[model samples]
Target: MDSTHEQRHPHRVVVKVGTRLVVDADGLPRRDFLNRMADEIRDLMDRGIEVLLI
Candidate 1:
């Protein structure tokens, strides 16, 4: 595909979250990190990119 096509269209992304990054010592979700990630994902969405989190 041409660079212009890529620049004009939205791209799909698969974001794989590591277990360590998603869980804490007690096996709980890390809210702070999740929140930061959400913010980043929101930014990407705003730019017309699709994000799939795993």
Candidate 2:
């Protein structure tokens, strides 16, 4: 990725979520939040957007 102010071309985006956010405070998986996130990502994908998550 370039850091120049006048040249901003992002061909891809990566979103990183920590385990605490993706999981419960107790360390359990959060299905509801995951589902909601999936929905939102799908919405973006439908618009021809590409997302890379880790």
* Alpha-carbon local distance difference test for all models: 0.81, 0.71
Model 1 lDDT at residue 37: 78
lDDT of 1 at 47: 87
Residues 1-54 of candidate 1: C-alpha lDDT, one tens digit per residue:
998998777597789887766665566579976777789999999988999978
Looking at candidate 2, what is the lDDT of residue 25?
55
**lDDT digits (tens) for residues 1-54 of candidate 2:** 457732454445577866757675556568876777789888778766688998
* lDDT over C-alpha atoms for residue 34 of model 2: 79
Candidate 1 clash pair list: none
TM-score of each: 0.59, 0.55
Number of the top candidate by lDDT?
1
Alpha carbon lDDT of residue 44, candidate 1?
93
Worst 10 residues of 1 by lDDT: 19-28
